[model samples]
Target: MFIDEVKIYVKGGDGGDGCVSFRRERFIPRGGPNGGDGGNGGDVIIRANKKIDTLLDITSKVKFIAEDGGKGQNRNKNGKNGRDLVINVPKGTLIKDLKSGRIIKDLKENDEAIIIARGGRRGRGNAYFKSPTNQTPRFAEEGRNGRDRWLSLELKLIADVGIIGLPNAGKSTFLSRISSARPKIADYPFTTLQPQLGIVDLENYKRLVFADIPGLIEGAHSGSGLGNTFLKHIERTRVVVHLIDISAADLLETYNLVRNELALFSSKLSKKSEIVAINKSDILDTETSQIIAEELSKKISKPVHLVSAVSGNNVKDLIKAAADLINKESEEDLLRLSLPDDYDAISNKGLTF
Candidate 1:
């Protein structure tokens, strides 16, 4: 029941109507109108909650309507205000208007909230109509209708590092070993249907959150295999851990195919900081692993590491390297932010992507 995206209808509560009554007190014979004003309607609000990891609870009940305000009473007694409706969703949820497909808000942080719809306005009472020209006005204003709208909700996973590769390339295996997340792993391809997030505690102070995206095959950018559904989950990732099955045939070809698919999907993603890991090193001889690593380094122009998720060989060193890269990128980002806003060097300082 990991429902991430869903469409739902929401409406604000309608305001209460004003009362129309005249004062009929025993002592006060010339008493004027004494009607009370109505209370305001409730609002429909959406808040980002870190505890909510999915939209399953919200999807169960599609329509959400707030409570209506209480009507006005006699003797200038105001009505009770309606209770506002609050909806909780995952932190990385995005809300869009159904008709125009315009993005209302992107809730990426915890406790972030936005008012999706407003409650109806309260009506006026006869007491408010007491004017010099028309002192004995009898009519009272009507309450305004609440706003109703259909909205589309989407969820994108936020992670520090993304583990991506072709089917059975050991992406999930690597994640399962490095962290506490236990994803379905099999000898066949596409064992994981959804993205899995895991937290890695390499050191007491250094914590890393990694996401294992669904396997990407050729034509993945054009809706092939798992397609772009899971690909967007890693858009916020700072580093990409590219896994290559050294035991598979044509390792470099598989790597290039995945890279090409990334370029087609998003140029910024293709340029993300990445490191190549030769997976399944335990299945290969020492000489063979070294040969493959040497060639991969030269081709990708990045330091290639040999790792075996099954034996946990060189996994620590690989993670340390990734942590170093992540720290380096963070420092550069802070430096760019410190630069003057109007400085011409800001653009070239790797600020925007």
Candidate 2:
């Protein structure tokens, strides 16, 4: 039921027509022009809401139209303006032009809104043309049409850390062990067909959001298996936890395969801060696990942590490592914000001020 992408058509309301009339009274022999102007049409707006988690509600109907303005009446009575139409979508939704495939806006914050279509203009009445040369002008202008377009909405989940690896790498089990989220788990591959999100509460009231993406296989970037469909969900993650099954025949090859797939999908995704963890360590002896970890660390040139999700052995250490790295990166980001906007560009040129 988690719908992330949807296409819809939106249209603004049309303006009302003007009226041409002449006033006539019992006492007055010739009255002046008394026609009224038409009202303007309504606009189509799209807003972001934090409470809404999916685009399923918007899929119920494809086309959305605003209310049209009322026509002008006699006695100089103007028509009523049309009401604006507001559509609510989940936060982190990107509105794109379907025809041009260009991104219009990224709704990352709640309450953010944008007017997608503009309403037509109102028409003029005969009274507006009443001048000295044409005292009894009977001409009236017609209303203009509204704007319409086809838009595509794509949703990307926001998370602090992403848990990624090949299928059946204990990702679901690891996530369940650390957070309250309950995702379906099984021994078979592709058990998690969709991405799962969870919140891990750390010490000092600090928390981190994690997303467990579906397993990646060979040719994932090319749309093989469930990789391409769900890989985009990890693009927003600040950090990634690479989970590897310790029982794999070639640990180094397994690690490289997933990394290559990530790089192929997005260079930015592969360059993110990564934490390598060997899961299902409870099956092996402590000394044996440590030896394997050390060997893998030397081969990959990165520290390898061995943890068992089932027994909860050394899992806290892994979480602590992720939190420490996240805090470190956050501090760096804050420091960068405190500096000049061109600090990086200026420093890279080797210019001394």
Candidate 3:
């Protein structure tokens, strides 16, 4: 039940009515107006929780409403304010206005919170209207209504590196070998229907989050196969590992097909730093695998690594290469952030991918 998107209605609590009472004491005849003010309504709040990874829990309930305020009491006593309603979502969730399709908030960090709907104001009591000239004012203001609107929630997985390729390209196998994630693996195509996440630990206590996105077919950019559904998940990644099967008939063509789909989906995604990995080296001889890797690297104008996900051969080298690139790209990003507003024009010191 990996739900990434959902639409629901949310509303803030309504304010309570003000009391209009007149003081009536046996001893004092001129007690004047002693009405109390109404309490303010409760607000609807959204919070980001690190424990939540999907929006599946919110789908069961469609509408969310906060508690209404208590009415004012006599003897000039103010009413109690309503409690705020808090909704917890995943850290990477995005809250948007359903009608206008505008992003209201992007909860990227844990413990971050924002008020999606504000509560109504409290009403004034009759005693507030009493002036020096008007000793017995009987009028009281009514409470205002709370805010209500439809909202859309979307979740984009946060990962440091993304493992992507065509169907049956051994993307999930590579993820399971490197990390604790155990996705479904089979000899057929489309074995993985959803995205799987894993955390890989490296030397010096450094770690990286990796995501295994579902396979991409031809026309994946235009909603073909599972590519369109899972492509957006790669947008947050700093680097991507393009895994290609070594047993494919044409290695360069298979690589180019996936690249073309990525370019069509988003230029920004295609521009991210990439690492080419020729998987399933155990199926072929060492000499043949080396020759194919060398040829492919020459054709693509980039270095290629041959690794067997099942046998775990040369996998460590591949992981180290990915870690090195991640560190380099991160340093460049930090440098760009430290530069001036016109940093791009001044220097081309960012990722060249």
Candidate 4:
């Protein structure tokens, strides 16, 4: 199961208690306080693992608690510290505080880790209270309590390009054809209920991650169909590949409907860099495919590519074009970040939807 969101309770380990003992030997004269300090508690940590794609494992186990520290021995031996508990999640997982509803960590890169709960401090032994004036001191500090909190985990897929369109628009097919990801393909709508990621390899071993999002309907923005469940996965993408079926009636109207849904969902999404693709060209003749592609290009005022995922026609060009656009956008972003104030104004041109 592909679970994106989950709520869990985590707690750190408690500190160990201090030891109080009096050494009694055969010939020893004055045996002062022979006490040892307690050991520190264990912490709760969350780590990002690239191999994980969902929060399914975490959901199975709701409550997570670290081990408690061992108590001090009678011979003035310090207690052992408890081991930390590490939870692994996907690379794009976001950890939020349940009480405050604030984002604590956005794990975007692999191997990134954050300490969710801190361990308690160890208690002091009675020997620490020994003074010159007071010969026999018997006071010892108690161990502190560990930290505990309720956390919410949400996973947003991180991909360079997101494949978006209506149900059965060949988004999954395109991903399977270009990359090694094999998503379930059927002739019905809503075939893909979850987001699927695939790595597309180009010439010279160049590669890009592509995500196939679930289909969007007319009321998708308003909690209709799959609604905004998978929309968040596409928010981090650099580019969106809008795939439209060429065999559908009134292709331009279908394109506009999808665009309107995107705008309603998020202004940022509608303004993101987009590449139009008319899929299923193999089902249509040359004249029909060209007409549909030309009309869509004119309607959207952007370049449109006619390609068939089944026949593998123009798919390579489409992939290359998408990669090139992503690279150019990255370069532009870098330039904007590095340039001075005067050059910043020129690079701040508003996005064209």
State which candidate has the highest TM-score.
3
Q: Give each prediction's root-mean-square deviation over alpha carbons.
A: 7.2, 8.2, 6.8, 7.3
Name every residue pair that clashes in candidate 3.
Answer: none
Point out where model 4 deviates above 4 Å.
Answer: 331-353
- In the range 1-353, model 2's lDDT, one tens digit per residue, is 77888899999999988889899899987999988988899999999887777888989999999888778878999988889999998777889999999989878778999999988888888988899999999888777888999999888776667899999999989888888777889999999877777777777526777788889998999999874877777776778899999999999999999999989987877778899999999999999999999999999999999999899898888888987887778666533322100000000111011
Q: Candidate 1 has what TM-score?
A: 0.90
Ranking by TM-score: 3, 4, 1, 2
> How do the candidates rank by lDDT, highest first?
2, 3, 4, 1
Q: lDDT tens digits, residues 1-353, model 1?
A: 56667899999989889988889989988788878888888999999887777777887799999888778888988778788999998877889898899988888788999989898888888999999998777878777777889998888777767898888989878887887777889988899888787777755325787788889999988998877777777676778899999977887788899899988988867878898999999998989899999998898787899999999899888888888888888666633322100000000111010
Query: What is the total number of backbone clashes in candidate 2?
Result: 0
Error of 2 at 174 (Å): 1.6
Relative to the unseen true structure, what is the C-alpha lDDT of residue 225 in candidate 3, on a scale of 0 to 100? 76
Clash pairs, candidate 1, are none
Q: Clashing residue pairs, candidate 2? A: none
**Ten contiguous residues minimizing lDDT sum, candidate 3:** 339-348
Clashing pairs in 4: none
Error of 3 at 118 (Å): 0.9
List model 3 lDDT by residue over 241-271, tens digit each: 9999998999999999999998998887778
Predict model 2's lDDT versus the native. 0.83
Which is the better candidate, 2 or 3, if ranked by TM-score?
Answer: 3
lDDT of candidate 3 at residue 222, scale 0 to 100: 94
